[model samples]
Target: MTSYTLGQKYISPTKPERGVFPLDHEGECKETMLKYMLCLSRNDNKPSLCQAESKDYFQCRMDRNLMKKHEWEDLGYSNEQQRKT
Candidate 1:
C-alpha cells in the first residue's frame, strides 16, 4: 500500500531551456555555474559548496534579462555579504 503525505510531493522545478541563459550564455558570469559544478565535484558532490556560485549564476541571469527583473533582491541573500564601508 502507498502512504499519503501531508504536503505536496516534491516535484523538481522546471529547468531552463537547454540552450538558454546559464546554459548557453557567454561571458565570465557564465562561468559562475561552472565554478559551482567544480566545487561540487571536489566536495564529494555536496550541493552546499556550490551555493555561492549558484547565487552568482542567478544574479547573472537576472542581469541579462534571462529571468524576470525586480526579483534579485528577493532571490539574493540578505546582502550580508555587502560591506558598510
Candidate 2:
C-alpha cells in the first residue's frame, strides 16, 4: 500500500551537462565571474547580496578540477565572505 503522487513530476536520470557555476569556468573565473554576473544585473536584484561573488565563482571551479567540492552548507551558503562582517 504505497500511493505517492502528490504532484508526480520528477526527472533526474543524470543529465548533468555541467552547470552549477559553469560558464565553462569562464576562462578560469574571469574577474570573479564578472562580480557574480554584475551582482545579477543590479536593478535591486539582491540574490542574498550575491553570496560573496557566489563563493568566488565556486571557489574558482573547485580549484580547476572544474567542479565537485561543495560545502557552503551544500551550496546554500551562509559565509564564504564576499563582504559581511
Candidate 3:
C-alpha cells in the first residue's frame, strides 16, 4: 500500500494516459502519475522514484533505479541478493 508523510497525502493512481492537468494536482495530489504515464509512453521501462506534494504536503517515495543497474550491484542489494537471502 502507498504510504504518506506528514505533509503529503496519498492520491491514488489514475488513468495517466489522459495527461497531467493542473486540476489533477490541486492541493498537491500525486503528480507522479502523470510522470509515470509519460515515462511509459517513452518506452522507458526503468522504474523511478517519483512524488508530488506542495510545500505543506508529504508522502513516501518508492525506490527507482537509473536505467543503469550498477548501483544496486555495488550495494549488494541487487535482485540476486533478495533471491539469495
Candidate 4:
C-alpha cells in the first residue's frame, strides 16, 4: 500500500496522488476528509466542532457534505440571508 510520511509520522488512507496514481487505498476516506475540512480553525484555542460533539457524532456523519444549515451558519449567514444572497 502507498503511504505518505509527514516528517516522522505516516499519513493514513494511502490515497491516490494527484493525476490518479492509484485508488486502491482508502484510509483517508470521505469521512476523514470531511472531518479534516470541518476542522478549519474555530478560534485561538477555542473548541472546534470535533471537540464539542459526542465522540460518535462525526463517526455517524462522516463522508456527508456539510448541510445547508451548517454551511450557512459557518458563513455567518442565516437561512433567510443566505437564500437572498
Candidate 5:
C-alpha cells in the first residue's frame, strides 16, 4: 500500500501512431531480415546500399501478415525500377 501525492499528476502512456503489432514469432521473415542486416554490415552501416534487402524484408512481413501491405512506391522504393534500368 502506497500513498499518492496531493498535487501529483498521472500521465497515461499512449500507443504510437502506427500502433503495435504482433512479432514474427515463427521467423517468417528471418532470412530476409538477416540479409538486410548483413547488407548493412557489409556496407559500413549505410542503409541506402541495402534497399533491395530492405524491400524484400518488408514484403515478407506483409505477405506473412506481420505488417500492413503497401505499394513499393509508397514504401519509398519508387527508384528501384529506375536503378535497374
Candidate 6:
C-alpha cells in the first residue's frame, strides 16, 4: 500500500499542443464531417484516399471557429495545389 504525505506538492497538467476549442453546437461543420466519414467508408478506411474530404472537413471546422486556423502546409495539405496542377 502507498501512503500519502501531508506536504505533497501538486503539479498541474500541461495543456495540449493543439489547444482545446469550442464544440460545434450549431452543426456548422456537420455536413463536411459527414462527407469525410463517407469518403473514409467508401475508401475502406484509407485516409490517404480521402485527403480532399479530410481537408474540407478541417476547413469547415476552422471557418466555424471549432478549431484554430492553420496553414495548409502545417495541416499536411501543402501538396494539394501541386496535385491540382
Q: Rate the local accuracy (lDDT) of all candidates.
A: 0.64, 0.72, 0.36, 0.40, 0.83, 0.83
Clashing residue pairs for model 1: none
lDDT of 2 by residue, 6-77 (tens): 998997776565354345634877788788889978837776777777788788878887778877666676
> Model 6 shows how many backbone clashes?
0
For residues 20-58, what per-residue lDDT tens digits would candidate 3 score against the true structure?
A: 223432323345555555555565554432111111121
Quality of model 1 by C-alpha lDDT: 0.64
Overlapping backbone residue pairs in candidate 5 total: 0
Query: Worst 10-residue stretch by lDDT in candidate 2?
Result: 17-26
Residue 33 in model 1: lDDT: 68
TM-score of each: 0.48, 0.31, 0.22, 0.19, 0.71, 0.71
Q: Give the Å shift of residue 33 in candidate 4.
A: 4.4
For model 4, name the residue pairs that clash. 13-27, 13-28
| Candidate 4, 1-85: lDDT as tens digits | 9886767965588755433432324444455545544653543434333343222233333333222123435534456644553
* Poorest 10 consecutive residues by lDDT, candidate 4: 61-70
Cα error, candidate 2, residue 31 (Å): 6.8
The local distance difference test score of model 4 is 0.40
Q: Give the better candidate number (1 or 6) by TM-score.
A: 6
